[model samples]
Target: METFVCAGCGRIYLENSQRCGHCGGDLEERPASGRGIVYSFSSVHMGARGMPTPYLLALVELEEGGRILARLADNDEGEPSIGDKVVFSGLSDTGPVFRLF
Candidate 1:
């Protein structure tokens, strides 16, 4: 199962689990309303712990109000920019990630 961190309160959640463990904040499977903007990003080239090289990581701001740091989808092209619109897809087995639409 996948897991996620609460943007509202920094609580961790299992995929099958609902709500924030620490704050009881409502947890949606995807970014609320399928809308968000890229807040920041980075390209990893080395020493990525358990991950492969050349991965794109980003912090995204949800339209409903919150920020989540996630990996960008593999199919994405070009560098993601601040304020670039994004949509939530499924979680990566290694981490949570969002795809650019």
Candidate 2:
């Protein structure tokens, strides 16, 4: 039910607003098909940022369009590949972490 509008182009976005800063043309409410590739990733070793240490952070490129940065779920034991098919998980109560399916 949350909403945001781009300051630059006046685009309205629903839950997901990372891509469409303005002009909703490229915006999507959810990751298309829940499938995406791991565009990049990083490991957090410090808890200074308020997140648990040793967590994986990544930018996932959705199959349809747009990219989102999220935390890799604890259940994901295998390393993510660039073109791996990832399924969409529900919004996180803690942070933006998605489960790999």
Candidate 3:
């Protein structure tokens, strides 16, 4: 996924605002490695905005040093745990999607 980095403070952002919020520096766009660990997650039984029910939402702590909220890909086996390795699968209609590594 595309991420923005602050030239002055090295802060990373998923949204590109053309300027950094921290140090008023220029933002540079970069590709993420798509590798991260599951920091936290929840199973949503109530769907919204056309999303299906019983989906997993997670906060992934990226190896590149930032966190992203993404949906976990459908897995029939089971749910993921905290600190489990995950990789970016792709973008869904909702947002970025991740899967267990």
Candidate 4:
């Protein structure tokens, strides 16, 4: 997986950003292990565009140290809880998606 590491403050982020939000410096692309745990999640009954109804969205706490929102592979995985193990599945045209590793 790929992420951006801030040259100014050494903050690693999963998104491709223009600059470091922390120190306003340049960013460099780097590889990450892409392991994470589900910190929090919710089901959206209504969605827009390509998103289907009653989908699961989770705020994953990346093992590399960043929190990102990604769609769950299983909407019917039952109620989500903190610390659910997950891995980076891939990227959607909309955003990232995750599944149990």
Clashing pairs in 2: 6-21, 11-23
List where candidate 2 sits over 4 angstroms from the true fold: 1-31
- After superposition of all CA atoms, the RMSD between model 4 and the true structure is 2.9
Measured by C-alpha RMSD in angstroms, how accurate is candidate 3? Answer: 3.0
1-101: candidate 1 lDDT, tens digit per residue: 23455657765443745768777776655424646789998888984578778888888887766677788886636787788888878677866778888
Cα-based lDDT for every prediction: 0.71, 0.61, 0.87, 0.83
Error of 2 at 2 (Å): 12
Worst 10 residues of 3 by lDDT: 88-97
lDDT of 1 at 8: 73
Q: Give one digit per residue, the lDDT tens place, for model 2 in 1-99.
A: 233445455444436646674444454343245666778877778856666688778887766555677777766466766665665565675555656
lDDT order of candidates, top first: 3, 4, 1, 2
Error of 4 at 98 (Å): 0.7
lDDT of 3: 0.87
For all candidates, what are the clash counts? 0, 2, 0, 0
Which segments of model 3 are wrong by more than 4 Å? 6-25
Least well predicted 10-residue stretch by lDDT in candidate 1: 26-35
Q: lDDT, candidate 1, residue 94?
A: 66
